[model samples]
Target: MCRLALKTANEPFSPYEVLQAMEAMKEGYDGSGLGLLLRGMEFEDFKYNPRFPILSGIAHSRKAEQRMDEYMDDRGYELKYDHRFAMNPEKMSGKMRYRYFLRAYRMPPAFKDRPQEEREEEMLRTRLDLRRIGEENNGDLTVFSFYPDVAMIKEVGWPMEIGEALCLWDGQIKSRVCMAQGRQNTNYGINLYACHPFFIQGIATMTNGENTAFVPIRDWLLGKNIPGYIGYQSDSEVFAHILHYTLRQLKLPLQAYKHIITPLSSRELETHPQGDFLRGLREVCRRLIIDGPNAVIGTLPDETCMLVMDQKKMRPATVGGRDGAWAIASELCGVDAMVPDRDPAFDFQPMREHTVIIPPDRKELQIWSQHDQLPLPQAA
Candidate 1:
């Protein structure tokens, strides 16, 4: 599958740009489906109610919609604003057989003043509950994300076809950061949940390769007993959960994620300053280690965008952009299409042992290597 991630320092941008880039790089992939994950929302309701969770999903019928409304009311979630897509009727059948809705809901009275962790946990539980209800009723409802300032859209169709059907180019749905994936349709068959750009809480990621170690990782995460980690519809979904577990649950540093998923060799670790600590992690997180050819591009709760590749470096990824905007993709041509006019010399592929990070500041981009003492920061 092809993936494109874009982040801008100033102004909200359209998801169309994301699909455009993916379309430009559509060669090997069949584009069986498209998934769009957006953050840093530019909608008016989001601007006014930034703290309220925005539920983005689909409902198969009016009965399902009524069930959702009643459930939310009983759970004490106050609806603040609602935005439903005017779906093109022709595309609303078969795999795309549902109505998409983006509703912003205020936290329940009990959670309004609760700790951030508690509030977030409740939100996740609510989403899971809704998902369970949907499954019990023959997939009547499918909630992708229930977090503030984040929205996701997944439909089985060509990038532009789905875009036009959803009326994404209308410009009402815009964000400062967007990660879009054009599915290549592999072993898993074509399912919406199996699409890339999977999200949980505030962590969203889209990968370009298969996870050979998916079962082990999924088992380990399920062992954690976190409801948000329940969905394994896509092997790559584990990547986002692993990130959330490491950063939010374990309270580990951002760089720790790179070491956990793609641990360095013993000899290489020995020369690193955090070698001792990393060695300990290698054993503890052994089950979490990925054994596949994958390139991951993700965004953190803090809007920090990052790209890292598997040890095998089988999947290609490139990062390039100018002062106020940046883009990462599976191909250089996609990057060129997203952020053109920048000096090509500055656009370099991240090495197998490296991680490219761009914090929300957007002032500079940092390149951190497993063997290096510090990340080399370059002017944005």
Candidate 2:
């Protein structure tokens, strides 16, 4: 007959603890009894959330096989038994018991892919490249947390509330900067968080000279000693300090440019101090176009394009819009919206992909155009 005893304890058993317990039980018994002890234990008794049950069972199984091996070595016995509790002492020997236990508790298969150390080294190299790019571009860049599309926040688990709070606060700071800079003339706006499969847009701007920069106003607020829930809230003031230091180092032409950096919540806008700032920014944009004609509107590449096509008036068949229109929006979306429908032949392709018209002289009506095409390098 099989004898099973379930231990009741408030504290859960770890895998090591379970292995120790099994070892203690094996001290008195030979191979004949050790296998029975293992098979008889009610695995359900050790079950607990997270860790206890699964690991303990694994430990118990390993301990049983080890004890059987020790018994076989000492006694030089071969063990035999029926499927149930029929242990014939004459037919069953220690050697047979060891073999039986070995078969029952085989080790799991090994992983086939690259070693973890190699994978980690690869990841480290990639991160280094990212850091170098950011540094070369004057610390202007966006970092995003990427996840699979099928993965839900609740199902996969994430700190959604905390993330939203930080994003909203960031947005507020950006909107304020946009308002102060004059949106219409400066072409400043916020960028949406890059959450899609494509590249992240509107994090930082790479200047014509290849130097990178972010919105100054948002960087300034991040440097203030303020109570907030963002991850870097404690070092907010440091962020601003870094921005100033970087700008000074780069010797950028800040006086000629206005920029804003707003954060969008998923697809929609979030409410916060930043939201109010964006409202003020919109008002500024409305006023600038109404009053100023020669003002140089500067915006991030994407926003500049968006504003030109969506909000400004443009001449028919013109590849580029007037100063005010292109100042705010300078992307394909902006350019497409500005051009009149009468010229079906006039199509606006990507500035980088196609040739741009360069006027030879202020008097000459004919424009010189050339396409500088370069093939994309093969990915490594």
Which candidate has the highest lDDT of all? 1
Off by over 4 Å in 2: 1-218, 221-380
User: Model 1 clash pairs?
Assistant: none
Q: What's each prediction's TM-score?
A: 0.94, 0.16
| Cα RMSD, each candidate | 3.5, 30.6
Query: Which structure among the candidates has the greatest TM-score?
Result: 1
lDDT of 2 at 41: 16
Task: Quote the positional error of residue 158 for candidate 1 in Å.
Answer: 0.8
lDDT measured at residue 187 in model 2 versus the true structure, 0 to 100: 26
Cα lDDT tens digits, model 2, 265-358, are 2222233323443344334322111111111111221122111111112211123333221111122332233222224243342221121222
Instruction: Report RMSD for candidate 2.
Output: 30.6
Provide the overall lDDT of each model, using Cα atoms, as 2-decimal numbers. Answer: 0.82, 0.21
lDDT of 2 at 260: 16
